[model samples]
Target: MGIRPLAKARTSFAATFGGLPSGFWWLWTAQLINRACGFVMPLLAFYITEELDRSAAFAGTVVAGIGVGSLVAGPFGGALGDRFGHKPTLVAALGATAASMIALAYARSPWALIVGAFVVGVTNNATRPAHNALIADVIPGKDQVRAYSLNFWAINVGYSIAMLSVGLVSFTGYTALFWLNGATTLIGAVMIATRVPGRARPAEPTEAEEAAGGFGAVLRDRSFVAFVGAQFLVLTILLQSESGLPIAMSLDGFSPSTFGQVAALNGIVIVAVQLPLTRLYKRFPESWVLAGSSATVGIGYSVLLLGDSAWIYGVSIVVWTLGEIGNTPTSFALVARISPDHLRGRYQGLYQVAWTGSAVVAPLVGGWVIHTWGAGPLWIGCLVVALAAAVAQLGIGTRLTRRVATKDPEEQPEPAKSAPASDAG
Candidate 1:
């Protein structure tokens, strides 16, 4: 059969699916579904502590298992994305994640739970580098920041809906939450496998580029390395919002439901504010934006030390959410800008590692600090980390902006004469 016209194909596809560039929709939908499924983590501590009769320390260990899996899988996942392609790897990882979630629902023994958490972590981390690299491949340079911002907004929307829905599932049972989580992951997998276009490989790598060593080259770049360290610290502080906040709430006489509200507030603020402010901030240098955001987040967390009241906690959430919105997209844009086209997957994967590695260790350390010393010490430590990250990012961001500015304007690729009219099969 003769191939249909691209425009006709796009029109039909848009009519059926509500958009074309199936790639963009696919990525956004996958994020939405994956995040919706991920809403279970906040509840997982409750399930293990209240339902399964596990200790706080043990529950923290279980949660950390996911991070461990992610760290283990991250580099290899990025390499796979570079070697093969993002679409297939993402589909397979999502499928694996779904299975892991289902297994987690059924887990009775601690070992089973740990294994399930690890699998989920690994698959979850693996999906990100591939997803990010694919976006770099498909989206134009000027549009990339907005695209990542939109993706972040979609994630929060999904998370907000999931948090709201979790109350209904609690009535059914905790296992039901796991099942729902698994189903959502499956939906993401299906969407990506069927709809997302695969990334096109570049013609070839130059000898110098190849000899410099793929991901190794990225690691070797001094400024990039600093940026990664800054990212690590930023995540170290942010992860506390997930692991430390609940403990702080409990110590102040709040119940599990109240803790859930606090968590939901984090998502709600991100969803409500991220898109509106993204455009406003886009004009600023990314370095200033990142430093300002990190400082904002640090200030927010520091404010938590002032009191344990619900309103105080709520205010803290709002502050951190704003900082989060400011930092996330800009950071990703910087990474996309610095990476060579052929090694984008590898760099994205490495970026995932910085965040994931922190996620694994930060909670364990934060939990221990809270258990042994006090919330004050933990929050104080977080503030210090944030300040350090801001400082490091200032330097990194300055270097990145300078690199972009100094590049020969004539050597830059000419803008595409016209937008590729349609993203159709």
Candidate 2:
């Protein structure tokens, strides 16, 4: 933690970015645009409730519809990525997402909003897996962790900017915010389609690879199944913050602004910590890191049960963010490592299906729990869920590590190689 060591860590992170493949910068650009637009959800919800004259409950249902659309789209998107290639899929998804956002902006009725949400959800959810599969195709194995971390960092930065912009502009009109969101998505689509080079699919995989059968075959792998399950639970715990934490914090006398600040802090922490930690953990066993991260998140939420003050809650956010930084990139890297080359998109889609499915359920359930029980009970319930996920991680950690270690070396990309530095602007 000394200045010298911190400087070294920073240098390492900087160097890793310097080494990313050519297409990565385009992917990063698209991610930034997508995430900046992503920050409009809170404003979107506000617009639905205040301007559209929808009840809060109805708005929540529309949001849940978005999740359902994403869940339904994931596997198909993954399959499409595997078949048609990542760049084409990314372009199509982004274009559709932008169009859907425009339609959503004009939606007048609750059903219309739901339909728009579903359209947006299906398109947007496809973007991630396609983008990730492209990265997995281009980047070296050792560099994948840094690539994912940088991607997340870009996302959080875009999110922070978008959130700030929405706050500033929504005073004018939420429709304006919606317009801006759509514009950004369109820009992202254009960037990916024109700027990023499409990854070349490996010369058609042999009969064995074909037999691997996309996500369906991937799902049958016991270790992969367990890993996906653990990821599902982690997402369930994370979604509670969006759905349950606000209600819980309101009950504890925290203002809406305070909740926003805490959530922003979570993003900032991830942006700050993810790269350095990814480097630090690169040499560690992925499974152990995942298990420990899960345990940390459970501990953090449990600590929230003891807190009534803003400072205490802030500390809990830090703890949970640390856990997030530790878990997410490693989990993604594992997926990339284990999946068949042709099926990376399919696997990522399946993984995202787990995530979106949890989003669909966690909010409704968390909201119901808050409405029925209270803050204390809700926090305890989240803690239990986190711990359960941790236990699941513990059960599968050894098996996953073994699977990773025993994999044929030829399946992985070469050791990390430095790319030529970008032109100094």
- Leading candidate by TM-score: 2
Q: Candidate 1, residue 116: CA error in Å?
A: 3.1
Judged by lDDT against the true structure, how good is candidate 1? 0.77
Candidate 1 C-alpha lDDT tens digits along 249-295: 88899998898777778887877668767766665667777888998
Runs of candidate 1 with Cα error greater than 4 angstroms are: 1-22, 39-61, 103-110, 168-179, 200-203, 368-373, 405-425
Kindly report the root-mean-square deviation of model 2 from the true structure over all alpha carbons: 5.9
Clashes (backbone N, CA, C under 3 Å), per candidate, total 0, 0
Tell me how far the alpha carbon of residue 101 in candidate 2 is from the true structure, in angstroms, after superposition: 1.1
lDDT string, candidate 2, 207-281, tens digits: 987886766687788878877888888877777777787877888888998898877889888877777777776
Question: How does each model score on lDDT?
Answer: 0.77, 0.76
